[model samples]
Target chain A: MRTILILIKKEFLQVFRNPLLMSILIVAPMVQFMIFPFCADYEIKVLDIAFIDHDGSRITQDIIHSFDASDIFVSHGIIQNKKDAEKMIQHDKIDILVEFPNQFEEDLMNGEATRIAITANAINTTKAGIGVGYTQEIIGGYMQKFQEDNMFIASEEQIPARLNLSYIYWYNEQMNYKNLIVPGILVILVTLIGCYVTALNLVREKEIGTIEQVNVTPIRRWQFLIGKMIPFWILGMVEFIMGLFIMKLVFGITVQGSIPMLLGITAIYLLVMLGLGFFISSVSENQLQAMFIVLFLFIIFVLLSGLFTPTEGMPQWAHYTNYLNPMSFYMEVIKKVVLKGSAFVSVQTETIVLSVMAVIVNTGAILSYQEKSK
Target chain B: MAALTIQKVNKVYNKTVHALQDITFEIQEGELFGLVGPDGAGKSTLFNILTTLLLPDSGDIQILGMDLINDYKQVRQEIGYLPGTFSLYPDLSVKENLDFFAVMYKSDIEANMDLIRPIWRQIEPFSKRKAGKLSGGMKQKLALCCALIHRPKILFLDEPTTGVDPVSRKEFWEILQTIRTQGITVLVSTPYMDEATLCDRIALIQNGKILGIDTPEAIIEHFKGTLYTFKSANIFSLLEALKRCPLQCNYYPYGEHCHIAFYEDMETAMPQFLQFLEDNQQEHGDIEPIRPSIEDCFIEIVKMNRHE
Candidate 1:
């Protein structure tokens, strides 16, 4: 333990001595926390539509009025022909074109079904798809109202086969993108700092041949590694707390569960992270190789972590693979604590899994790292 | 008791290159030992093995009466090592580096101030200067101070004076001699043949094998032939002509002279040597018989061993 304190002292001096690296270590995460939420947003706005009314009728005017009334869309006015509507769509002034058939009102009066052909640009797939969905919903409601006004379907509301489809969103009531994404991005930043800094610390020593000097001493492998890990562990916590503060200040995200519990989980997860760094440094030949290995692993971890996408939507094999990713488990744990205010017992399984990982990976690193390769 | 004992040690790299081959040596408790050879002569490989940083492939080593594998932890606590390269944290100031090493050894800098005062005094003025900013000589001193801060029982220095200036190299050797007076065994390696004389005993090693081991004077006296220092104004051509001559002698380049070994005594070979020099028009410098140094003995032994 005394040796470990000395090692930690040495590690801290080395870390704080390089002012440039220290600045980068502290400032990079702060900038990421401030800007990344805005980049990962998923909301869309502003819809424009054009109409080519084949039949000059009152029902068609009412069909256009439904969309124009909502703030989501604006009408570019009725066109003389389909060609004019297509021209407006080509000029990028419209997102969709609505064409009513020639006998649109006549067919309704004769009790025959009529069709309105809505053609979406489909160039921007998501925008076009959602725009078409909204337009269809409006038309369906308008047709129902039109029939009711005429007393043609007065008993349709009495049908027992309809679904109320009540939806209530918890955690983020306003569907604020920042609230959901900031916590997730904070997990990634913390993981990167923890893993990248530790790997570089050891590998830099190897590059400068300082490890040999340490190897010549009486220091045990576990003692040396423990000492090496402590500084970064403390630094990671420092960065995490700073990130938490910025997260609350910029996006107003506060942990709902016990802050102490969250801190405890973070401390253990950092051990697994530092172990990963040591493992990578043990095998890599140089700094570039270690950097690339961490990068490759980070990419794989982030994609499978359910950070930006839903893990439930993935294949069964991919869904099961998330269990192996520590980052995935931590991401879930952080969200549960901060966003949902989950009780400690509720997150017991993930925390326990992380603890086991911390033990296994750290022991694995200590065994694999040898003072001599041969 | 001997400070270190290496027995039939062999190291093979890449499954082909013999890094160390059947090496054996022993150093007394207070002796200053030097492993003398040129680059790629397995000097660093041997130093690494002795320091417990490397394990030999096929032999056993004992350090301070403890088996290397069984008692490495205890052995490491007792030895101080300076590796083949500069390895202290470059961004750290001299004082910080020293303090950190002292703490690592579970000792205090104040405890060993008397031992490192000569080195530390030279560097004390620049104590706050970053290690990277110090000159090469100062860096050597700082490395030496760090290695000695722990008051180790055995010191292993690998090529400590390989790139140091002549004056600093001499001073560094003086420090080692002073360290020896304190009854600490010192094991040092160097490629500069001149440094061999400063050591009490040296092992002339080449190609992972020890050719000879003895005091500098004894090794020089063991050379079996009369050595002649041959020099001319055009030294390169002189070396070329001597090697081409039908004199049946060994001619190898010493610093500025071509050192040729003749099995016959100098009285019997001088007339023949002068005849050849006349035929080759190599009369710019006088030919004279000179006593052999450690370098002459090394070249001769390497040639003899390689041929066999």
Candidate 2:
């Protein structure tokens, strides 16, 4: 235990001594926290749209005016022909084109149903799909108002009872994307500090041959690894607290669950990450190799953690893969605790899984560390 | 008692490249022993094996009568190793590096102050400076100090003086002498032949094999040829011309002179050699017989092994 403490003290000395690394550990995460939430939002607020109106009727004019007044669609005004609107979309000037069929007013007057063709630029499928939905809703509302004013007397008896639907977002009431993304960025911040720093620091010693010097001593491998782990683990916890502060300061996000419970889960999650880093460093010969391995695993961890997208929407194979991803488990726990005000009883399963992972990975790390090579 | 012993230790890499073959040697307690060889002579490999950083394919190694393979933890506690490369943490201060290793062995600085004081005092002034900022010689001195911080029974130094300046190298050997007097065994390796003479006993090694092991003077005395050194205006051209000489001799350039070892008796061979030089129109100075150094003895043994 004394040897481990000495090793930890030495590691802290080296870490604090490197000015560039210190700034990266403290300052870069804050900068990333400030910028990442706003940029990674999935909600599309503005979409430019053009109209190709074939009917010069009152109803058609009213529909175009209503679309222009809506918040989501920026109407590029009416083009004379369908070809011109298609050209506008192809030139990237418009995201969607609304084409009204010819004689649409006469067809409705004759009691014949007509169609409006909505052509959307499919390059950005998410934006295109959402834009198409907005166009249909606006036109549908206009048609309903048109019928209520002109044909209400004839269709009063024919119109069936309509169903009204109301929506209430459960956890995120305002449906603020920032609230969802800020917590995920916090997870990423803690993970980078936990995994990247520890992995690189150990491998840096190997490249410099200091590990060989340590290997010759009576220091046990577990003692040396634990020593290396403690300093980085403390740094990771410090980064986590700073991230929470940023989340509250910038996004007004507060953990509704018990603070100690959140910290307890974070502590165990960091163990899994640090243990993974230790395993990588022990097997690698230099920092570059360790960096690549950590990056490869980190990418998988973040992408599959439901940070950017819902895990339930993923394919079956990807869902199975998430079972092996530690971040997935932690992300669920953190989201529940931070957003839903969940108590320990709610996040019990994930907490147990992370604890199990911590033990398995750290044991593997200690065992795989070969003090003597054959 | 033997401080460390190795018998028939062999290491093969990837089923080829025999790095150490049938390597056998022993160091007596309090003796300064040298493993003298060039860069690839498997000195570092043997050091790694002895330090418990590597395991031999087949061998028997006893460090203070403890099996090196089975009781590596105890052996590790008793041994101090400074690898060929500078292995101390560069970002750490000098004092931090020393204190760090000192604690690793469960020994404090005050406990081993007398053992390392001679080397420590020279570096104490720079205790706050980062190790990487030190000069080449100072870096080595700091490494030596760190290696000795634990006061192990045997210290393994691999090419500690390889890149150090001459004056510092002399001082380093003096410090080793002092370390020996404190009753700690020192196993040091070097490519410099002059440093071999400072060791109480050295094993001359080449190509993963031990050529000979003895005191430097005895090895020199056992040199099998009449060695001669002579000045030449153009040593390279003289070396080229001597390759065709009919005498059974081995020749190489030594500093500014050419050294030749003759296998034949000097009674007839010397007169014929002078006549051959005259006939070849070679411009040279007087050839004087000189005693062989460790390098000459090493070359003689290597050549003899190759011929057989």
lDDT of 2 by residue, A1-374 (tens): 88888888888888898998999998999999899988998788999998888897887888999987899889898899777888888999999898888998888776677989999999999999999988988888787777767773446764435544566898998788888899998889888988899989888888888889999988888889989999999999999999998889878999988889999999999999999998999899988999999999999998899998899899999999998899999999889999998988989999999999999999999998888888
The TM-score, computed over Cα atoms with residue i paired to residue i, of candidate 1 is 0.92
Best by lDDT: 2
User: Would you estimate the TM-scores of all the predictions?
Assistant: 0.92, 0.97
Ten-residue stretch with the least lDDT total in model 1 chain A: A158-167
Query: Mind giving the per-residue lDDT tens digits that candidate 2 earns over B177-265?
Result: 99989888999999999999999999999889998999998999899999999999998888888989999999999999899999999
Task: Give the least accurate 10-residue stretch of model 1 chain B, judged by summed lDDT.
Answer: B246-255
lDDT of each: 0.87, 0.90
Stretches > 4 Å off in candidate 1: A47-97, A103-111, A121-125, A141-166, B265-268, B281-283
Residue B183 in candidate 2, Cα distance off native in Å: 1.0
